[model samples]
Each structure stands twice: as structure tokens, then as C-alpha cells.
Target: MKIKFLLMIGLFTGSIIYAQDSLDTRPDRARIIGFSPAKNTKNVNGMLIKYYDEIDHEIKPKKVNGVGLGCNGLGIFFPALLLVSIPSIDNWAINDIGGEPLPDKMNKINGMQLSIINMEPTITNGLEVNVSSNISAPSVTNGVAVSPLYNFHHTTNGMAISTFANVSKKCRGIQISLFNVCKDSRGIQIGFWNENEKRKFPLINWNFKNKKS
Candidate 1:
């Protein structure tokens, strides 16, 4: 019958060229383009072009339920942005860029991240605000990390604030600081110098193991 209508138009032109080669190999969904400053173009998602290496090489966007503005999310690779940074140091060389760090993967950032100066990230679950430093990675933040000077982390579950320092190696929750260190603390440390190799308190420190209910 005319060779089955030329084999059904060659299977509909090979399914429209395999659906345009699967949408050009998927991964691009954030577009608001207008400002251009060079063009390196990769896979960008939402609100494009505003300096910073032309949207920082654009590749992050495995998921971003909503909102993302940037000056430094450190050349994102993956983190599901809800990111907002606008006070640059341009990520402070971000793990020493251009040789070993080019979105060298390992960004979590579930939601809420506001930065004005520094907000390093290797992992973040929710809420991380910075004015100076809120560095992470070694263990990384789970939730809530605020900063005025420093709130470095190696492992923190929740709550870590800093006016001066709130370093951590392992803290379950809460560590407000004028200098609060931790090698291992279960919870609570609000102070003008509260350390914990096991327990050292000048203002307040806790191991907190009360669970009988």
C-alpha cells in the first residue's frame, strides 16, 4: 500500500529526531536573561546575567523550588538554591578557585541562605545567614547558622550564632558565642568563653543527656 505509506513516514521522522536529542541532553530551566557580560553559557536556571563570571558558569539546578539571587553561591554545582548573596568578597577565593575548585561538587543547601559577606557551603539544611563568616564543611551544618564574625562548623545540628566565634567540631544544638568552642558537645553553650573538650564552662555549657520520657 505504497510501502505502508513509506513506513509511516519513516517512523515519524525518527520520532522527531528523538525528541530533539532529548531536549539537548536535559538540564536547563532557569531563565530570566537580559544582562549580558561576555557569555560562557552552560545550564543556567532562573535570573540570568548580573556579572560574577556570567552567572558563574551556570550548571547548578538539580532542584530549586523557588528563588535564587547571587553574587556568591560559589559557582554552584548542586544545592537546590534558595540562595541570596549580595555582599561580595566573591566567595573569598572559594576553596582556591581555578585549579581544584570549579564547582567541585558537595553542596546541599536545602533552603534559605542569605549572605552579605561570607557564607561558605559544603552542606546546609536550612537557614544560614552571614555578615562575615559562616564557613562550613568538615561535617557541615544541619540548620541555623548565623554570623557576625564567625560561625565556622565541622558538625552542627542546629543553632550556631556568632558575634565573635562559635567554632565547632561537633555540636548537637545551640552554641551562641563571644567565643564558644566545641570538640564534642551534646547541646547548649551560650557564652563569653565556653569550651568543651569534654566540659569547660565560664558562662554556660552543657552535655545534655536528659531523656527519660
Candidate 2:
């Protein structure tokens, strides 16, 4: 009984020491795969199922380098949708990539983002699949975004595909949807109604020249 008690005490002491050390380290350890609230200070390199809204781990910088499945955040960029309504001003002036400093949250996902409706003001460099809608404007998506309703973002360097609409401040690849809009486009827009800084067309629109749009 005395040996067992000693062993338990030793384990408790070790745990406290490790926790203290982790607070000072660059996240001494991480949760490889788990479902928890987004309050972890450690960076996640595997799958993370965020049950609650993402929060900033002010103690240290955090990132999710793998798959991220999140809700509770529909994005604070609803006003960016005004890019379509307000056509008089240049879209880049109000909201552009690197315009605002990123929040100290889980503001980046380097892999697949599975969103039932996830729209965080973060940069996503991989595939973003939204079951409903992804309205992460004034942010950036560097890969492909496949959505059912719409994909509205600040900048898309690859492709944006949606059934209803695809809107962006700047597009360098392609936008294919029922209604497509780009403030500055360097590629093609194929849809029923396409509009860019250059012109608006019915079937297709392309802007491959040096003209600034």
C-alpha cells in the first residue's frame, strides 16, 4: 500500500512539472486527434473536430495544419457581400488580402476544411468543402472551394465552384457558377451571368491582359 501511494504521488508531481514546462515551450505537446472546444494553445497536426467557436490562445501561436471540421463560426465578413451591391468603389480598397491583421485565433487551416457552414476570417490553403455556404470574404482561399449555395471570399487563386454564385474581390483562376463576379480577374468566368472589372457577359468572360481591373 505504501509503494502504491508513493507511485501515485510521483505521477502527480510529474504531471504538474510537465504542464508548467509546456506553458513555456512552443506547445510542448499537441492533441493529435480529438473533439474538443477550440481553446487549445497547442497547434494541431491531425484531424480536429472543433465543437465550439474558435478562440485565440494568447499564450502562444496556434495553427491547425491538418483537417479542420468547425462550426459555431459563420464568419464576421457578411459585410463583404456588399461588394456586389456597391459597385461604384473599388473592391480592393475596402477589403483586400492582407488588409487587416489576422486575429490571434486559429486563423489558418493548411489542409482540408470540412464546413457544414464554416466561415472564419482565416486563410485556407487547401480544399474547402461547404455543405451549405462558405461566406468567408475579405479572407483568402488558395485552393479549390466547392459549395452548394455560394462561395464568397476575398481572393481565390485557383477555383471557386458553386451552384448559385461565386464572388471574390480578386480571382486569378476560374469562377464557375450561375452568377460569377470578380473585381479583378486574371482568368476565366464561365456561367450564365459573368461579371468582372473588365466587362459583363452572358456565357463566358476572360481577362488575361495587362489591363488593371
Candidate 3:
């Protein structure tokens, strides 16, 4: 059973990578430094910067291999609003979105992302730090995601730390926050209120296998 489960997991990840690899055609370019609405650039090996007004989600997503910074000029009001919501907004989002959000537009990051708020979907493999109300994945693959608000990911194979809430449609790692939910949990959840495929718990929750299957 364990072997079968592992094989299924491997196949699932393989499929996602294979599908995304199709985006790397001849037009993809690599740059030392890049800016948002990255045009034809497919990879950024140094600094990648973005401004609030320059985003066009229709543009092809770039792969940032180093550092990313954006949403620089929101003054204090935007942050204050997000901070005020706290656990309430995070909880509301969880119930409203059901599981995790669909990633209509996405960028791939392999290092660090620091932003006031995430403007688009992301597949992050390193550190992600933000002041936004929620950070949903394409999935936080193998790193840490830190936010002052909420985090909801399609898959969680990394650590998620948030002040308000953390959730994953499918999980294989840890979540630390005020509220934590995992649709199909295979790891640990540490929070005030926790929910998983197995049960609803408080303070901590965990599920290692799908017994029903």
C-alpha cells in the first residue's frame, strides 16, 4: 500500500512538471535582471522586480531564480486593512474558497519572494515572505512560506507559517497558524483550530494514510 501511494505521488508531480515544461519553447530567454510583464523572458537569475501598475496577467510567467520584490508603493492603508482582518478574514476565505484557489496565472520562483501582496499565482520552491491576506500556491513545494495573513495552497510539501490561517488542498508537511485545514492531509497541522480528511481537531491534527482507499 505504501509503495503504491508513493508511486501515485511521484506520478502526480511528474505530470505537473511535464505539463509546465511545455511553456519552455524557443521564445523563452534568460536575463540577469528582469522586470514584470517580463515579455519574452523565461528566467531571471539575479534580481527580479515588479511594480504595482505594470502587471499584465495575460503575459507569460517568468521563472525567478534569485530575489523578487514588488507592490512597493501601497502606503500604510493597504497593510493596515489586511492586518485588521486577522483571523476573521482568513477563516472567511477558507470557507468561501472551499479548498484551494485555482491558479489562472502563475509564475515559478526558486529562491525568495518578498512583497506587500502577491498579484498572481506562484509555484515557490524557497522562501516566500509577504504581508498579504493569503498566499495560495500553485504549491509551496519544498520551502517556507511566511505571511502575516492567510495561506491556502493546492499542495503543501513545505512549511507554512502564518498569523491568521493556513490550508492546503493536499498536504505532506506542516502548517502553523491560528487555523489550519487540509483537505487530504498526510502530515502535521499545528494551530488553534485544525481540520483534515481524517477529522477536525484543536491545537494539532495529523493524518498519515488514506484508510478508506
Candidate 4:
């Protein structure tokens, strides 16, 4: 009976080892596969021109500044999205490569380019900032450009601000704003890179309070 029990244990151990080996030998899941990350290069160009033309048309004696702010805001959002989505992409890359290490160049997303035309920020009470970034403007190659976000964080009076910009030559201006307000005995925190992982620090934190809203 003891010999039979030992044989069963050995078989179970062998099965577990084989299962682990099979998983190890499996191919990785896909993350990114293409020439570039942007969606439709030509369309991106068209969008840029369209945005620029609209802004130029809307330019008047009174709304010139407004046009600029609109452009800046557009610029900021594009990059923010890219940066925020990188981790997911990396995970896919790992899976696709079957746990094989990524190439030095492809390990981290790079070659991100951006151009901002007529970006202006309007600050209110030093705590709030209004901005615009042009997404489409004319490019050197006469095509539209797509930019990526790197890092940005701002805070005032316990309020926190995060920004993402989409700067391209064709549109000549567009941006997105992420504003976090903290008031009434509240506060805020900001983090970056690996700081957000490992349960360390949050990228952005805040508390809001009733004010002159």
C-alpha cells in the first residue's frame, strides 16, 4: 500500500511539472503589431487641417484667445491617453512574446512626436487653469502629426490638476483637461511612473469642498 501511495504522489508531481513546462513553452499574447501606434495616419492628417481651418475661421476680434485655449486643451489629452494606456500594452507584449523579454527599443513605447501651435493658458485665482492645444496644423511633410503625452501634474490650494495634450501640425490646436479640486479640509496627491504601481502613491488625489461655485 505504501509503495502504491508513493507512486501516485510521483505521478501527481510529474503532472504538475509538465503543466508548468507547457505554460512556459507557450507563445506570448499580442500587445502591439504594426508600423506605428496611431490609427490611420492619413486620417490624422485630415483631422489636423480641419481643426486648424475651423480655429482660423472662428478667429475674430473678441475670440482669438478662446481659439488658442481650445487648441492647447486638445494637445494635452492625446499624450495623457497614450501614457495611461502604456501599461496595458506592455502586459500584452509580455504575453505575446511568451514571457520572452522585449527588445530594448520596443520595450517601451517611443518615437512619440508632438507640435503645439498657439497654446495659451488662462489661470483663474492661481488655482484653476484653462488651456487649449492645437491638434492639427501644417507639417513639414504636408501631413498631419500625432503627438504623445509624457508627464504633467499641477496643484493649488489642495486642488490637483492633470493635463493631456494632442499636438499635431494639421489641426494646429486641441487639448483635454483633467482637473481635481480639493477644498474644505481636504487635500491632494500626485504620482508618476512606477509610483502609481506597488500601492505606493496615487497619480492624483484630492478632496473637494463647496465654494463660490
Candidate 5:
């Protein structure tokens, strides 16, 4: 009986070991040890030991309910409530091999993003603060984007303030900058120069869709 119990224990131990090995082999479950030339070629959900260029396509956390740090090339698919980075490139969306827009599989960031240089997320749903410039997403932004240099976006639903210039295809909220340009302006624009498809106005411009009486 004792021999049989020992045999069962051995089998269980082996099974556990095998299970762990299997988990480690998964493409998304693998952790990045350091700067790996081979691993950088694929997308992974893990911790990066150091910063690398390919990290934009590699290191990503599955989910972030807490604080996270990204040195550079941090590609995040999931919403990071609070993400702190020092001069990092975030390629949350997948681009074509030729660097063209895919449109359908755009990435979405749902929290506060703090960066030093620039932010080019597919979509930003919260506050995006950049020390230098904020590059608008190809799709849309539903929150606030603040930058000292410039801010650009395809569509903006909230507010965008910049020191130099603010450009957008369509705007539904407020835009404050030295120069503001929008294709379709539905709200208020406060700047030195405001240009819209309707007309170009100095100091301030606004276009409210006429509501049917």
C-alpha cells in the first residue's frame, strides 16, 4: 500500500511539472528576460528586463489594474489605469507590414497615459499627457489630451489643449491652442487662429448644428 501511495505521489509531481512547462511555452504567457533578438519579433505578455526598440511589438501586460512602468517600446493591448513611462513608444495597434492603417484592429487605451516624448495610440479614452507632443490616434479620442507642443487627432469628443497647435478632423468639445484647425467644428475653439471648413475666424470660432424646431 505504501509503495502504491509513493507511486501516485510521483505521478502527481510529474504532472505538475509538465503543466508548468506547457504554460511557459505558450506564446502569450512567455515572460521577456532581457533584450532578446528572437523574442522581440513576436508579441508577448510579460515583464521586460530592459528597454528595446522591438519592445513596441513584444512586451505587453495582459491587464493593468495597478501601476506599470515602461522604459521604451511598450505595446499595451489592455487598458492600463495608470501607466508611467520615460520616453517610450506605444504601438497598441497592429500596423501592416508596409506601415499602413488596418482600421479594424485599432488598439484602445482606457486610462491615464503619461509619456515624455509622444503618444500615438490608436484610441485614447482617458487623459493623455505628454511633455513634448501628443500625436493623435488614427481613429478617435474620447478624453483630454494635453501637450506643450502640438496635439493632433482624427476625431475628438472631449478637450484638447496645446501650446502651439491643435488639429483634428472633427471636434465636438473644446480646443485651445495657438492655432486650431478642424474639418468639422461642432463646439468652441479658442486660439489665435481658428480654421474650419465653414469659415476661418480669428480668436474664437464655433459651429453648432442647427436643431430643427
Candidate 6:
């Protein structure tokens, strides 16, 4: 059973890589966000949170589900942390359409036909630099978007970790590439974007150090 499971895992990862590789044809200008086990304590959380929050705040609801990123959705994205961020009115917005109630538009535009696979975290650098990933093929064939999601975890050393993912269609932006990360003693990071950005936004970062598939 273990052997069969391992083989299946390998094949699934290979397939994601293969499909993503087709869209990553221009590697020269691509952004590379590398993940390494941190030895330094000071810069570790800063870097991790910097990237983590960026993924959480900017990426989560924007891509994973179609809602705007907000404090309420933080835990939804980062289940490992269970941290709830209270949102100000500014964190939310309301728009009016001709004879349409607010809740109706929100219902249709704020949620996605989505499934979240694994969103957990490990500790590091006195923070939870958790990791998470989602596994869902796009539902709409053309120009559909999903909500942004966050994953939180803590390392054995008690470092806080969080991961983020978001997908959407833009009028003038580049394509969004999706893939998985299968290798990392601690975790694997996968990003999505076109060729111009310095980093493809991480849709999921999974920490598999203590767990086995």
C-alpha cells in the first residue's frame, strides 16, 4: 500500500509539473522564489512573514475564491493558525447595481466552486510560517476567477508560517500558471504568474517535514 501510494503521489506531481511546464516556456525572465531552511532568527520571520502576509492579504480571496481579501477569510485560508483578523469597514467594500441587492452580487461574485485540499503550517522564528496548497482544476473554461486562500502552521522550533494562493482574470495582466511542489524536507513552495514579475505568487506552500503521504 505504501509503495502504491508513493507511486501515485509521484505520478500526480509529475503531471502537475508537466502541465505547468507547458506554460512556463520563458524561463529566462521568470521570478524565482526559493525556499530554504532558515538558520538566522532575525531575518527569518521578516522574510517569511513578508512573503506569507503578501500571500495571505494580497493573494488569498483574490484567487482562491473570488472574494476580496479580508480578515474573516484569513483563517479560512490558513487553517493551521486559526488566527482571526478583525476587519475594518475599509477592509470591505460595497457597490450598488441597478435594482440589485448587495447580498445577491456578493453571493455570486464572492464565492467559488472550489475545494481546499491541505492547509497547515509549521513553526519557525517565533512565528507560524505555515504551508498549504489547493488542488482544483479551473472550473470555468475562460476568464473565471477564484478566491484567495491562506494556510498557517508552526515549525518544531515554534516559528510561525503562513502560505497564500489566489487566481483571477485581469484585463491587462499576464497569465496565471498553477503547479505543485513535491520535494522539501520542511516544505515545498509553488508560485503562479507571467514572465514579468520578480516572483510568481505562491498558491500553496506545504510543510511535509513531520508528516508522511
Can you give the TM-score per candidate against the true fold? 0.29, 0.66, 0.71, 0.20, 0.55, 0.18
Model 4 ranges off by over 4 Å: 1-68, 73-151, 161-213
Between candidates 2 and 5, the lDDT winner: 2
Q: Which of candidates 3 and 6 reaches a greater TM-score?
A: 3
Q: Per-residue lDDT of 1-213 in model 6, one digit per residue for the tens? A: 999999999999667645543554443322122111211111111111111222222222111222211222343554444225523323211111012111111111123222232221111111111122221111121223222333211111111122232221111111222321121124333454111112222453444335345
Clashing pairs in 5: none
By lDDT, the better pick of 3 and 6 is 3
CA-lDDT, candidates in order: 0.53, 0.67, 0.69, 0.25, 0.54, 0.25
Evaluate residue 129 in candidate 4 and report its C-alpha lDDT on the 0 to 100 scale: 25
Q: After superposition, how far is residue 5 of candidate 4 from its true place, in Å?
A: 96
Please give, for residues 13-89, the per-residue lDDT of candidate 2 as tens digits.
66764564445454535555534443334567776565544334332334678987865444324434543463432
Question: For all the candidates, what are their Cα RMSDs to the real structure?
Answer: 15.6, 8.5, 14.3, 23.3, 12.5, 22.1
Q: What is the C-alpha lDDT profile of model 5 across 103-202, one tens digit per residue?
A: 4434344565455433333455677665543332354668898876666677789999988667777789999998787776789989987876576777
lDDT string, candidate 1, 79-122, tens digits: 21212432233222222321222244433445654554323234
What's each prediction's clash count? 3, 0, 0, 50, 0, 39
Q: lDDT by residue for model 3 over 20-133, one digit each (tens)? A: 444544435566656675444567887677775234346467788898776656523555765676554235333444354555566778898878766566777888887762
Best by TM-score: 3
> Model 3: how large is the Cα RMSD against the reference?
14.3
* Cα lDDT for residue 67, candidate 4: 14
Better of 5 and 6 by TM-score: 5
Q: How accurate is candidate 3 locally (lDDT)?
A: 0.69
Q: 83 in model 5: Cα distance from truth in Å?
A: 28
Q: Report the Cα lDDT for candidate 2.
A: 0.67
Q: So what's the TM-score on candidate 5?
A: 0.55
* Model 5 C-alpha RMSD to native: 12.5
